[model samples]
Target: MVKEIVLSPDEIIEYIRTEVKVNDVLEIAYNRVFAPGIVLGITPEDEETGEGLRVGLALTGEILSDYVEVDFHRLKDDILEIRHNPTGDKDDEEHLIIIEAEMFDNMDQK
Candidate 1:
């Protein structure tokens, strides 16, 4: 079975710290697009930005292949759902995070 949870920005950071690990594959959905990438690393909260967790991902696509860092703090309100172990495996499962479409809509304003 898959477990779905809605968490605040801080809670999400805590969850990632305890549950997620490097090299784990993650699927992030935003702006009606799914970007699946391997987890590179997780950065702790930065006092300057007051941001919680910053996840680095190596995204590869047909046309574009690059490294991108996702600031969970910025997408706090945009986070829609977090699905754990979507494959229903007792161990060795992946995560899928769905964000609201508007997340990228106003990206330039951020």
Candidate 2:
């Protein structure tokens, strides 16, 4: 059986910090587009920057063009939806973070 765990913004941050690792697959949503990528690295939250956690991703498609750094603080405000372990592979459990589109029109506006 497969389990689908939906995560709130706060939980997403915590999940990334304690669970995510290099080479994980994450599909990030931006401007209504879902960009799949491999996690290249993760930088722990910086107190001075208050950036929460910075995730470096090597986006796989043409949409993003190149690597990008995702700031967890920004994601907290902008994230529409998150699904952990979408593939349901036991061996690769908790390695996938799926960002779906348009759960909220604009969280910042709310």
Candidate 3:
């Protein structure tokens, strides 16, 4: 289905720049050189479980995509349709992810 773009490029770039700068400064200030230095976001617990998840992932890994076509993105209102193709690597898991977003935040703004 056709979709509308909720976020403009300028907004995404600006937000990402601000985030990267803040994260960098904090990392340096605290002498934290670890991976996921600042792009780590904690996922809230499932409704059935009250505890948060322990998985850690970088912002890029979670948002950026090296593959396209097979993976399609369409933004409509507050919903984003993302169809990602499964690769031969990692057991090949095909999935269609529908995201509820205020804007198009799928592309890596880095």
Clashing pairs in 2: none
Task: Provide the overall lDDT of each model, using Cα atoms, as 2-decimal numbers.
Answer: 0.59, 0.65, 0.26
Off by over 4 Å in 2: 48-50, 62-65, 83-110
Weakest 10 consecutive residues of candidate 3 by summed lDDT: 67-76
Tens digits of per-residue lDDT, candidate 2, 28-93, equal 664565656678899998888666588887877765558888887776756665544434332464
**Model number with the top TM-score:** 2
Tell me how far the alpha carbon of residue 80 in candidate 2 is from the true structure, in angstroms, after superposition.
Answer: 2.0
Error of 3 at 9 (Å): 1.2
Query: In model 1, what lDDT does residue 1 have?
Result: 29
lDDT at 1, model 2:
34
Worst 10 residues of 2 by lDDT: 82-91
lDDT of 3 by residue, 29-90 (tens): 10122222232333333568533322223333344522111100111222222211122122
Sequence-dependent TM-score of model 3? 0.19
Candidates, ranked, lDDT: 2, 1, 3
User: For model 3, what is the alpha-carbon lDDT of residue 105?
Assistant: 47
Clashing pairs in 3: none
